[model samples]
Target: MRALQQCLTLAWRSLVQVRHNPWELGDYSIQPILFLVLFLFVFGGAVAGSTEDYLSFILPGVIVMNLVFVTVYVGHGLNSDLTKGVFDRLRALPIPRWAPLAGRILADMVKQVLCILLLLGVGFLLGFRMEAPWWGLPVMIVLLLAFALSFSWVMVLVGVMSRDPEHVQLFGFTALFPVTFVSNAFVPLETLPSWLQTLVALNPVTMLVDSCRGLLSGGPVLGPALGALVWAAIITAIFAPLSVRALNRRLMGQGGAA
Candidate 1:
């Protein structure tokens, strides 16, 4: 109970900080809308038959992509807090070591919700609609949020390990771009070579995307959804404690070797 309260307090402060910094929202809000519009309008017919078809195919991928990129910035936040000694100050408090990380993750989740709404609004304007029932919508959103949280653990690790936040941005793009695009983002897995297809089929990103599309289209979803959940659980189990330990070690004046 105490840890949860501390987390909420820290999360609220982090949100206020975000409100004061308009640039963060702009980057998350504007960029996804721009990319979705440009790709659906300009390249839809060339690649995916029509705008409507492309929207159905691409909207799921777009949402996943947005979440993936947004979570990457968690690393930047971590790096900034460390360099500015905010983390060091937090360490002096009686709060749990995981409290601040939990708080930041929650704040990022709220930002993600806003981002998804903006993207969905833009997508609707572009003629995107899910054929599934109303109940399915919330389920899809929950699954996507879970996937985002699972992925954020890795970002937290990177942020804890980074000595310089500036270079973290470059490393984020370099690492995430390949994992994202190489999945079932743009093209159908059937279209890829056997080896590439195998990789995409095994990619957790692809499973999440597939599950989301299934929920949206009212298609069968037993496999992809289950697979995504299992992967998320495994990732959380492995990284959450490691992250806590890393933060504690860092606060003790240990290097960022973790």
Candidate 2:
């Protein structure tokens, strides 16, 4: 219980930093809206016959893509704290070792929620409507957050290993671009060649986007949703321990240097 309180306190600290550093918020807000508008207008007609028709298709996808991309901030912020000596100060406290990491992740989940809602609002303004039941929205949020939480562990590992925050962001986005763009996020699966379609079908990003589409607009919900969850499980199982270990090693090295 005490650890949970510490986590919340640290989470609040992270969120409060946004007041002094508003540009961080812009990454979550402006970039996503720009992606939504550009894709919806530029490729909508050629891809889906009209912007209205494409809005439904692309909104959920953009949400997923944006969610994945936004996770880079977790690594960036962690790397910044490490390099800036914030974690060193926190280490003197009696709090649990994991609290800082948990707190940052909790704060990240909050940002994810805000980003999701913002995109949904913009999507609605652009004529996107939810065809699935109201419960689907909440369910989708849970699923997306779950996947994001798991995926952030990968970035957390990156943060612990990288020498600086810039490197973290560079590695994060460089890898994510191909992972996201190669999926069915911006285009339909059938439009691709058979070989590419097969690969994209197996891509976890494709599974995630398909799940989001299922939960929001109406489609085969169970298979894609389950597949996404499986992917999340695999990611968490693999990366969570690795990240924690790397963080501990990095902190120990810093202590030795001091």
Candidate 3:
């Protein structure tokens, strides 16, 4: 109970900081919107059939693309706080050491929600329409939240192991851009060579974006949705505890150094 209270308090503080700095969050929310418009308006007609057809296909890609990239920020923020000894001060309290990390995750997850909503709003304006009923919207949100939690777990571990926030950002882009662009996010896998098509189809990111689109398009829901959920579970299972262990080791190592 005490730990939960501490976590909630710290989480609120982190969220308040985000509220104060709206522009930074806005950048994350807006970049994908511009990318979606630019790509669909400029190249989509020549690449895909029509602008509307491209919008339907690309909206899901854009949502997951934003999510995959923005999550790196969570890890970088964690790294920054740890490097600056912010966690040191928090550890001085009687609360569970995990509370701060948990709080950070919670706050960042909220940011993910905001980013998704903004992208969705922009998508709607750009002529994307969902074929699913009203119930599907909430379900899609839930799935995305699960995905954000899972992906952020790995990033938090990366942040814990990182010495420089800039390097984390660079590494994230280097790793993420290929995984995102290579998949069926902005294009079809069938258009690729046999080997590239196989990889794009198997890419967990491709599965996620496809699953989200499936949900919205009223396509076969159970199979792809379950696959994405399973992937999220496996990732969370592996990385969540790993992140915890990494955080503990870092904190203890700092204590020894002091």
Candidate 4:
């Protein structure tokens, strides 16, 4: 119970930082809205025949893409804190060691929820509608967040090993851009070459985008959703322990240096 309280307190602290650093909020707000609008207008006719159709198709993909991109902040912020000695100060407190990580992740989830709603609102104004039942919306959100939580560990590991916050962002986005785009996020798999189709079909981002589309605009739900969950499990299994160990070693090295 006490640990939970500490986690919440640290989460609140992370949230409060946005007020003092207002530009950080723009990453979650302005950037996503721009992506949605630009994609809908630029590729709508060529890809999906109309703005409205493309809106429905791209919105879910945008959400998934944005969610993946946003996880980079976990690494960026953690790397910043580590470099700035904020984690060192937090370590002086009696709170559980995991609480800081949990708190940042919790705060990130809040940001993710806000970003999702913002995109949905813009998507609605742009003529995107949810074809699935109401429950599907919440389920989609849960699935996206669950995947984000698992994936954040990978970034956390990156953050731990990165020399500074800038490197974390550089590496995160450099790697993520290709991974998100090479998949069928913006276009149907059938449009791609047969050779590329098989590989994109295997990309986890394709599964996630397909699952989000199923949950939102109506399509095959179970298979893609299950694939996404399995991918999330595999990622967490591989990266979570590595992140924790790396964090411990980094902190211990810092302590020893002091």
User: How many backbone clashes does every candidate have?
Assistant: 0, 0, 0, 0
lDDT values for all models: 0.84, 0.94, 0.84, 0.93
lDDT per residue for candidate 4 within 52-102, as digits (tens), equals 888888998899899999899999989989999999999999999999999
- Off-target runs (Cα >4 Å) in candidate 3 are none
Clash pairs, candidate 2, are none
**On residues 129-199, what C-alpha lDDT tens digit does candidate 2 reach at each position?**
89999899999999999999989999999999999999999999998999899999999999999989989
Each candidate: RMSD to true structure?
Answer: 2.3, 0.7, 1.5, 0.8
Which is the better candidate, 2 or 3, if ranked by lDDT?
A: 2
Pairs of residues clashing in candidate 3: none
Worst 10 residues of 3 by lDDT: 18-27
Over all chains combined, what TM-score does candidate 4 have? 0.98
Per-prediction TM-score to the true structure, in the order listed = 0.94, 0.99, 0.95, 0.98
lDDT of 1 at 45: 90
- Reference-based TM-score, model 2: 0.99
- Model with the higher TM-score, candidate 2 or 3: 2
Give the true-structure RMSD of model 4: 0.8
Q: After superposition, how far is residue 16 of candidate 1 from its true place, in Å?
A: 1.1
lDDT measured at residue 75 in model 3 versus the true structure, 0 to 100: 86
Candidate 1 lDDT, 1-258, residue by residue in tens:
988999999888878997678898876898888778887888789878898788988888888888898887788888788878898778779998778888999989899888887887888888888798877778888998998898888888778877888767778778899888999877788878997898899888899889888888767677999999999999888887787677677777733432
Residue 220, candidate 4: alpha-carbon lDDT: 91
List the lowest-lDDT window of 10 residues for candidate 2: 125-134
